[model samples]
Target: MSVTAPRGFRAAGVAAGIKADGARDVAVVINDGPSRAAAAVFTRNRVKAAPVLWSEQVAKGGRVRAVLLNSGGANACTGAPGFADAHTTAERTADALGDSAAEILVCSTGLIGERLPMPELLAGVDTSVAAAARDGGLDAADAIRTTDSVAKISFRRGDGYTVGGMAKGAGMLAPALATMLAVVTTDADLTAEQCDRLLRAATAASFDRIDADGCLSTNDTVVLMASGASGTTPDEEAFAALLAEVCDDLSRQMIADAEGATKSIAIEVVRAADEDDALEAARAVARNNLFKCAMYGEDPNWGRVLAAVGTTSAAFEPDQIDVAINGVWVCRKGGVGEDRSRVDLTGRDVTVTVDLSAGGASATVWTTDLTNEYVHENSAYSS
Candidate 1:
């Protein structure tokens, strides 16, 4: 299927001096007529961004016409002033779009604990709103990235409609919600509840399954909006399926772009007592740095996999476990079976499989390899 964005949405990105790098620091995405509905999920971190708190409250009503996003200032931990800045930003965009401030969602990313430069932000908002065009979606994607080497965007066309998204994150990413920021737009006809349901289910399997360093962020947010401009309404099941695919695509992109990551790892758990047990086992393996480093070095260390699983709640007998690395059966019946020297990690993708010999449930999680560069980059992040 050809990937494309829906009509009725225009995007623009402009630099307002928020970043010392002078990159695009603000973005605006506007939904024209037939403003569909919106739903969102944010970080569980108690130290939330002002924009996150503001958007969460606005999203409660399910109607949004625009989103104003800024990069290079997290707008977190600034107390009332930070919230005021978020409200001011939203109001600026709303005024430009002729929409109510409550109808404009806000998102921000970058170094935490600093106040936003309001003058520059307001200037960027004006420029973005004026530059908005249907083809400008990619620019908006670029504007929201920080420390990300490349902008992550995905679009899928299905049954006379389209779903498009842009995501940004390079560190502090883990399960429950990666340290990511995303804005997804669709022309499909869906109710607010339907959008929320689809997003939650999709995230559970995709974003919620990736763990870079087992560290969650204080600013992870995913906002999905439906513009209903396609004029073709899909059944609930079809919409859900399409939404899930879009989310999965973005999730994979996030993993592939992990900070200093050398390889993308897929951890699969099978023959578990239940789905939850399978997921628990998969997550444990995904978060293990030793397991990830072994994969990065092309070492078939099945013991790390076994150790990870043993730390989880998944019911399993050590003697009955089976494990594979890159389709090579390195361990069988809880013991080394094949020669570990045969495994290869010279490629950018790797897969590890584990079987519990318990029941029939299964799950898959995505992750990335740990490297010295990851440690170096994060150690001096504040400097």
Candidate 2:
């Protein structure tokens, strides 16, 4: 389907001399208004990318006019030089947008430990600025991809407002944010604090709950910007609902596109003492490579799920745990309950449910099955 760009946001994409493949590598998203409120979330990992560090600090003020992003090289672990390159990118973008350098957030994704091609990137910035247009959102989305096979984008329209987003990540994904880089734009009138609140809540159930592999990225980031172009402003509750829907759509897309993924798994944990407990249990299973691989082979390995949950402190009695796969009661009271042959998992989407019987809390985590292709893809990734 041909997705439309969000209202009031103009975008541009051009080759930044970063990708040797000759695909567009740099992108900019500009708010055409006088100013806009912004909120952002960054990788929880201490070893963060230079651009993430810069953007995190800039987002503290809750105002941003533009964002600069590049692919093909994650400006990470390069120490001071990487920071300088990131700052230069942001400064150039800000200059083009006629805003302060601090108002331009920056993001980068790709191979780590290499310095960005500054000369080419600087030159490309001008080209991107010149190409800026209202219909360039798709181009910008396409420019930020690395190992992703296809660009991931989504949009939701509300009363006189819209929420649009794009994300990229095919591997090095897990909770605590993944190797993903996402940009969400909205035309709603919202304060920086409100945006932050809505974003955090949305992410907790969406991106924050997905696991492709156990690995995390140094450049993970999710940013939201409000152009305030829409005159209609909804209440906090209404806005939060819409934000959740947008985030859910983006999160599902990310899981479906996981590198070497032939099947997507949704691990639902129910009847936990609280939300955190349910999430902890679900994530434990989501990150289990053995479990994922078994599922990939269409093996009804309920024991692996039990083992994963047992490793967590989620207050679940072993005998009270119930498991279901694709609506088949695979296990009851921690043991096999039904015919394993009845469950079918040849489809691209798979669902597994674990009932803790501890309380009323519940959580769901999305993950992908592990296969030989996954190993092969990462084995020679750096080469």
Candidate 3:
């Protein structure tokens, strides 16, 4: 289940000698479309990667016929030559596919500073294009992973259309669109405007709510392409709901396979004065490293949660808040309610619920517990 799971798409991944161990490092995705409408979101980081810069222009036209991605080197902070490399890659891909260079998008991820090996990368692109097939989405997913333990893929079916996607993210996941590269494809009949709205709404409820390490990446990008192959135009509301469902599934997969993570945490904030308040409080708790570390240790340290929530101006009185861990009420009315010892955290999944007692608004943020493995992984990432 991946971007190729939708109609009119083919994908492939190949090893290009960019990674030291000869792992797959290059991927190609092609849309044989009747209508190649598209939309995209990029990292909000000011220091953008070369591919991100190029893709910003490509997506503005709201149509993409092909995408080339690599996982060996992040072409970031490399100045004009880096952008030239991205443009050359797009041109090469277009040449291989008999498409215009302007219809091709490029994406890359890895160490932030080094330039990509152009010769090897260009050769890899040729090989990836040659291998592109309808069943090659899994290989493409594998090819886009760095520091990730698994390839994330998801699928959702509508009345007569289907949405499928692939994602790679395990570290540097933060609120500014998360450090990841994701591609979603659909056979539904939709306009570019619909694609843009659906992508933004889905990402806001999914990727934008996750904070693994609170670090933004220069190469983070998510693209949604519509091929109009299914020949069925769905209701906008139903389309958005299904799109959000696929995004949520992918987000859960990303957290479950997070780098060096032992626990996947869900922080839910309820009873807030407004949706914005609920979202802010949930994000505050999700980004708290102290609370994450405590969660890793299975310590029912509700105080850490309270401290995080208090930092937000979410219109909640200290004495009116409540917290529950794993269905066990540990804090109530800003005081101890149940025995903290009764809360369990033995499983890989943990849920923390906070009640602001202000209103009925609610929100959820997905996060991962902090651990020594995370530190070790990041410490040796470049080596």
Candidate 4:
């Protein structure tokens, strides 16, 4: 189950003819709720898609009844016409739901620098709205994919509420979000402000920590909608924890399915000067192509890790840093400790521990190994 696993939500996915292969390309999720408080986060990239621009305004209103998403064309870099198309999309969805356009959010993903086929997309919206059902969560998740080999969905049950979510991404995953569109639904009663605060915190600890390829997407979006249908006012802290877990689960799924990736790596930075320092150090290594390539070759190259860390401004001593791979301390105090060959990286999962030895604060960043398949897949991505 995905977003509709939560109470007061209905979702549907339909073949929209937007993708040449005729895959399900459009999805709609509606909150048929007693409360429609919503919060969302978008890509930090300066070059945002038209849907993102429109959705940001919708998020500001803090109330959303429906979200319309399409995966086939990214209405980015298309100027005013693209913006108009996005507006029209929201208006059409709003008309179908009998809600104001301001209460509808739109998200788009796929090849950038192109316009969407509005006729097919809007028709798909209408069809999905008519087909929306409580059990259509899986279908909704399946519709929002481009390079993803499988749909990503996660759910968690709380004391008296449930949080469910779906995401789509297989490449261009980076900090401040990824090349993804995610929708999360919760039945706990929450104010719009609470939704906003909790969503941001949850994303920061989850989506914001993953850097699959260090390439930010213009259409990245994550939305949390509270229906208050459970009729349970959950403890804020507990709800936040549950929401974070779902987001983290979806994040890991994205990494596992990253385009052409063979190894999913977790770079854990411990004993940093602060949480920010830990994040900086970890992200530096995660984004380093050299380190990613080393992982792909099943080589425990601690030198590559040290080199990446040296590029960061995080509080750390060059000679005091310690690096470990798969429980083997390959480098201790910035020098050789355990034999590098003793560390195994042949598995699909790898862990790199970096001891900053600065403080107690720690953070982890998820990433994937660089591979020849990744290069080949991206070379013809726009074709």
Predicted structure with the largest TM-score when compared to the true one: 4
Per-residue alpha-carbon lDDT of model 4 for 232-306, expressed as tens digits? 999999999999999999999988998789999999999999999999999999999999998999989999999
Ranking by TM-score: 4, 3, 2, 1
Query: Which portions of model 4 show Cα errors greater than 4 Å?
Result: 172-178
Which prediction has the highest lDDT against the true structure? Answer: 4
The TM-score between candidate 4 and the true structure equals 0.98
Model 4 whole-model lDDT (C-alpha atoms): 0.92
Query: What are the clashing pairs of model 4?
Result: none
Worst 10 residues of 3 by lDDT: 170-179
Tens-digit lDDT track for model 2 on 1-383? 10225567888778877788899899888877533888998888899999998999899989888888888878888999999999999898877777798788999887788888999888878788778888888888888877677788888877777888888886433222237888888888888888888888888778888878868789988888888777667677877877788778888888888878888899999999999999999999999988999988998799999999999999899999999999898999988799989999889888999999999999999999998778767775553
Local distance difference test values of all predictions, in order: 0.83, 0.83, 0.89, 0.92
Give the clashing residue pairs of candidate 2, or none.
none
The pairs that clash in candidate 3 are none
Give candidate 3's TM-score: 0.97
Per-candidate TM vs. native? 0.95, 0.96, 0.97, 0.98
